[model samples]
Target chain A: MINSRDILETIRMIQDENLDIRTITMGISLLDCCCDDIDRSCQKIYDKITTKAARLVAVGNEIEKEYGVPIINKRIAVTPIAMLLASSGGDPVKYALTLERAAREVGVNFIGGYSALVQKGFAPGDEQLIRSIPEALAKTQHVCSSVNIGSTKTGINMDAVAMMGDIVKEAAELTKDDNCIGAAKLVVFCNAPEDNPFMAGAFHGPGEPECVINVGVSGPGVVRSALKKIPDGNLTDVADVIKKTAFKITRLGQLIASEASRRLDVPFGIVDLSLAPTPAVGDSVAHILEEIGLETCGAHGTTAALALLNDAVKKGGTMASSHVGGLSGAFIPVSEDAGMIDAAREGILKIEKLEAMTAVCSVGLDMIVVPGSTTSEVISAIIADEAAIGMVNSKTTAVRLIPAIGKDVGDELNFGGLLGAGPVMSINTASPAKMIARGGRIPAPLQSLKN
Target chain B: MRAVITVIGRDVVGILAEVSGKCSELNVNIAEVTQSVLQDMFCMIMLVDMDKCSIPLADFSDIMKKLGEKHGLSIHVMHGDVFDSMYHV
Candidate 1:
């Protein structure tokens, strides 16, 4: 028996509080598509993706209407292209073009997996693909790329970290006129997840199934609204509220994931328990932090609030869904999140503070726009800092810094839509050139160390 | 298949009759209906068996949406599983 209270609450969450499935990302394995010839590999890649995800968008729309819940994006994630490049041994850009075409053909908003995992060291095709990211991203419209340079068990790969600095800059420079959109699509990461359903960092890991459906859920507004109702609640009460709200949100994702999997006949993957925020007014993770007794998002107690929120979200979400993976926590992307945008523009949210928040939050240094004059070495140093956090803490952290080509601090770079806009925040200009130049692996930390 | 159709708006004449008429036209059998009038605002929840509906589920949703707009009410026809999955587990 369905109760009216639950039905009304669900409706309110969807209608007024901005509850929605962030994405239904179909993960397609391209291991079988690898070929010695580049063109043949590209052809196989395109055919496999188009065929597997042919009805993804249509099904997403049907589910959205039938369930009265909004499905924001129907996207795809594929096995890292570097493995295909390893066998094909040709222009990595060809794979990017092929992915863009497949995304267009299948009518998906984005296609992720132009990626390489050299967390410990460069593989056969890793370095080449990393170098071609700038050009590949500049040419393609819907393809997203990510590179993992470090992991907790293996430590940081300094060589790939240095190379990614140049790649990130080139990606920004190549698409300078288009709002540095290329940089927005490229992510440099430590401990990257292969099954992430989010854009700019999602890639189907080699271990994933031939084809699977992963759902990412979002609802910062719902959480905030719940918190607002209990204004006098203690810290424990805050955590409880978040847990209850997250349970409802994740259950929705689990339902959608299983249904989509049943219809598509693809194995259901994880339901990422992330509070992915949009540029919309109520849908901001930063605002949720403020609601949890903070003066502002980047204030003194910001990190502690974020930690509680992230932990409670996972605690609640884990019980709701059968399996949960991806970067399953509160995402604090500065540009894409409305509260972070306001705090950032007002200088309350500093890059250093964002770095600190990332230590406790899900992702790191995401959607931040810095001055174009910022050097590759500085970017590398930032990535190194983020990688260190992930390395020492045994968590996933990534850097997606967009260099506003001709814009200075206080200037805005607007990408429009879900990519949102950001004011060019200040960054440390001190030269880390020597540190970045001395490229060698940073050895792994002891796993059992306390305090 | 079962769906929960909820209509919320200012209290007006023939609200239930019109909604039932649309459902009957589409061969959707309503098993249970609960209506309330709170402070002059009308609220109704209808649990309908959608298996015998003539149109596809999505199309039926579209028709309900258009009908709601025409009558200036907020109408939502969502699958029962949404409420079940969320409220049960």
Candidate 2:
């Protein structure tokens, strides 16, 4: 027997509160697809991905219908393409094109893992792949790229950091005609997770299984609505409300992950208990913060508020799923959240404030647009600052800044749907050219010496 | 297998009969049903056994959705396991 109350609550959460499975990413390892010839490797990679993920979209649709939960994206992640590039040793764009073909063939929204892991230092194929990101992303429609340039165990790779600045800028410039969508598809990371299922940053790390299903759950609106019932609750009461809401959200994710894994016959990976927000009016994470009694999302106590929210979500979610990995925390992508966008447009939310917020949340400086004149060195410096935070705290942080070419402060680029639209926010123009020119790895902190 | 069907809309006569008629046509047994009328809005929750259902749950869900649309109601059909897994340990 099922309780009518629980049934109605579930329905309300889905229909009214905008609760959803953010993504069901199928991680397919392409190491076995590697070959000496680039073309041959591309073919093998395409064949493997298409064959493995052929039923992903169909299964996702079936589950969405049967469970009555919206699964927004059916995506695929592959082992970092740099490994395959090392063996194949040809123009890296070949792999990107092949990935695009496979994604379209299998009818997936996006295919990630056109990526490299140079957290320690660049390897044989790393620099080539890194340099080609701009062209590759500009050429392909659904391929996402990421580069791990720092880690807690092995300090920051300044060389890769510096190069990534130019890469990020070029990625945007190449696709400037299309709202700089290229740069939005690239992420530069520190302490990057091997099994994150979210896109623009998701890549099947080399450490992941041959093939697996990872799920990301989303419900900022549900959390906010839950908090709304207790308007005068103390901070203690607030955390409890958030934790309870997170528990319900994650249980649904665990159920969906298990079901998807069973249907696909792939190993179940993990449930990413993330409070990811969409541009929908009611689905903003910043609204949850406001519901927590903040004046605005980027106010003085914003960091403290985000810290509490992030911790409570983890505390509640850890017990709901058997395995919870990925960047499982509150996401505050500015353009993707309506509240954050409003804050940014009003100048209440600045880049520096967002940087501070990232230290307390899951990701770092995501989906921000800077002026066209913002130099590559400045972009590299921003990456360095974010990487330092992730390195010291032993957490994952990433930068997905779009240098909106020919755009300036107060201008806006509308990418629309999911990627959303971003106002061109102002950034400090002080040149970091001297510091960026001094490219060297920043040593790992004492936190890494635990052993 | 069992599913939960929820219909929410304005209160109207024959709302229950129309839904149950479709369920019976599909060989689905209505194990339990609960309904509430707040002012003019009506909401119903039905626990249905689909062990001997003639059509797939997905198809039945679509059919019910269309039926609800015809009457300006919102209907949802979900597996009982979804509720069980979420509400229970």
Candidate 3:
């Protein structure tokens, strides 16, 4: 049996290792809010949110107080607004603004639903929603966005794919000074989930109930610390140990979610059994990848190893929680995950290799640090490239690059705890700036219309 | 007309501050609270004191709605009697 102190130690690893739950998103269906009248529709959306999300942040805190475990984000996911308000016929931007206003009114940091589903083909509202990406994200302080351009089951939605390529570029242009921050607010997905609690990635699936609570489990440090105990452990045995550990870890999440739902009176939502990696030194998804056998972070076998690791953890967590969903895999965020930093220092991981890894697992390039000296055009180019992968492959992908204020390649800067330390990785410096400065929206690619 | 305040949101500034402010304004005492996040979403739970409160449940709910929207949130307030039976029972 895992000792009680071991549990406390797990909790401590999260604290000392800069680990915490990445998200605790409540899923609320907005189907009932659908209507032709803008005001009436707004009213329904507002009522549904306030009625269902009133105590969300508060209850989440109470649990934190008792367990001494921190929840980093308290958020909500509603039905894709496109599905609900597309029939407004024209100018979905205004409705999106209304949704943005309501999200502010309710007090959640980000409200995700400026979304569309073109996996098979574009829905009328999806086109409108896609067009609203740059404007909606730019105008609103807290409205995150996503587009499901494809899915594994559906293969890929070519048209949706093509459009998103341009959309990401547009969003990057809209928020160029903010680190091309708009791209951070959106994701392109394949086999998009209905009840992912993390965003700009989360959305209420059509199959979900009116309202439910979804939990995202994290503590890369806890897993990392556990690994330290068994240094040089056999790879096969590591899988068994990881499964048992994940079972207990996910059970704790299940308990917390169940208790929260029972106390709050909402139906219990699923547990997002994802080992969300953070910038903290001890809690790194890349560390797990390396421990599973890799000479460096961006080694040749990275993706195959990550896919296997994701599958094993899911098998373990599935046994732990019946209600599991969301992006339940190892998050390989370079700046935010500690192990990647070590690999970068060791000259083992490279930017291109990380890109290849994204083809398989982890939320696409996240918390990556590039030099401030790099031009905005290059940043936009990077965004376009990453989005292209997500769009064509039809999987959820995002980018959060920090253009370090005065940093250079081969130099390291520490963000201090949980945010993780980073090495400003080298970016191609051949002045792709000229190409990016040309800056017109990349037209929707021809591959976008498979459906 | 007892109610339960379940707060699920992120670890951001004033999540605790704003909710507590509302509870006190409504003359609702904080019976219990659990502020924590899971799955990248934050949440909390508070048992309100409606015994001597002058406001109606609907009014309290509206005040909550206004405050919640001002901050970009999704809030849900349930009657304690109803909440307990629905969830606990």
Candidate 4:
């Protein structure tokens, strides 16, 4: 029994509030596509994805019209190419190239699963894929790469964690044009959710259905507005007010996703109820913190405060939707979250503090801005540090640091709205590049080997 | 005597206020109530002390049934002991 007004407001959210089916990610397992011959496997991989995903865009568009909801991104996630390569004898770079070609042909914005789960440790093809990440991602526009270097169960695999520090630099150097956008597509995770439909973390799990639809709902603006209206500022009231507002917002997501799935004839994935902050002015996790009485975001009690916010959002969101997944927590991208930008400008938040906060949320250190002159090796070290956090905790984490050219510490570079602005944050003078520059695929963690 | 009322449908205008108003007129004291919207559909459960009510259970339940059907909702009336045994206890 939907109300006409609630229906109208839902429609308005789609038409204006940047609300869209964040991703219509089709997960295709490549197990059936595998063969001893590499080319045959590639052909099977290509055919399976393109054929299965052919109706993806049309279906998304139809739903947008019928329900007046917008579906923004259409994507595909294949079984890890590394595993496919184990039986199909081919060069890693060439295999990645085939994946990129298939993605372009399928017309999906991004195709994930150029990944390896090294949490416990890497398997056979993991080495080849990790080694070829820079070349593979650089060679193809549609391919997104992610590596799960740590998980809560196995703890952080420091050796593999050590190597990824350098891989990021190579990736950034390869895609220099999109403001080091290659690094933007890479994610490092702890307990990476198997059903995450968002890229660059999306990958078809061995256990997933061949094709499915998942909706990642983000509305930091809604939360911010609620926070802004609290006239009297008590920390207890702030938390209570946020909890109630989040309950309503998450309910909206659950309804929209359930309705969308019913109409599209696809099983609705999780209502990712993540408070994913954008560069939009009021729609930031950091801003919410500031509104909760922080003069600046990265102040002394920042991590504790953020942890509370992150946990509360999850608690309320889970109650709203049973099928919740995909980094269902607040996102604190430094460059993309406005509150983060101000904190960096005020010299309160730093890379180290953001790393500290990831222990409680899904996405790790994100949207940070480092000095452009900083070497890629150090950037890799940052990736490594963040990766370790994800691995030890078994949570999905990522790094989206921007190396703004000609900008030094304390200098602010604004990406403008939903990708807000970030101050050029200083890096540790004691560099890790020399250590990261060592280019071998670090041996798979010993714990990964089993009977 | 007691009666449990349940409303199952989508949330809309005046459902709670109007239904509660009827209960007030009948002198039925609401002991407990809770509601939630599940995937666009609303479900509510309410317990009332019908012993204090002026109207008979049949009359009060009749009013709820008429109002609910008018607004495209389904209404259910149950005895207090049955309602408590099934839901409360």
Q: Give each candidate's fraction of reference contacts reproduced.
A: 0.84, 0.77, 0.00, 0.00
TM-score (all chains, Cα) for each model: 0.98, 0.99, 0.70, 0.73
Report the C-alpha lDDT of model 4 over A174-222, residue by residue, as the tens digit: 7666456666667767667777877778887777776666667676666
lDDT of 3 at B3: 62
Write down the worst ten-residue block by lDDT for model 1 chain A.
A442-451
- Please state the interface RMSD for every predicted structure, separated by commas: 0.6, 0.7, 13.2, 16.7
Per-candidate Cα RMSD to the true structure, in Å, reads: 1.5, 0.7, 11.3, 11.2
Off by over 4 Å in 3: A1-11, A292-295, A341-348, A359-451, B1-89
Clashes of each: 0, 0, 103, 16
Q: Which of candidates 2 and 3 reaches a greater lDDT?
A: 2
Tens-place lDDT digits, model 3, residues B1-89: 45655554455678788888878876778776655577767766666667766676656666675676776764555444332221221
Ranking by lDDT: 2, 1, 4, 3
Judging by DockQ against the true structure, name the best candidate: 1
Q: lDDT tens digits, residues A147-221, model 3?
A: 775544444554555566467667656765555556567776655678888777788888889888888887666
Q: Model 4, residue A295: what's the lDDT?
A: 80
Runs with alpha carbons beyond 4 Å of true place in candidate 2: none
Model 1 lDDT per residue over A54-100, tens place: 99999999999998889999999999999889989988998998999
**Candidate 3, residue A180: lDDT:** 54
Stretches of model 4 off by over 4 angstroms after superposition: A1-21, A259-266, A372-381, A391-394, A402-423, A431-451, B1-89
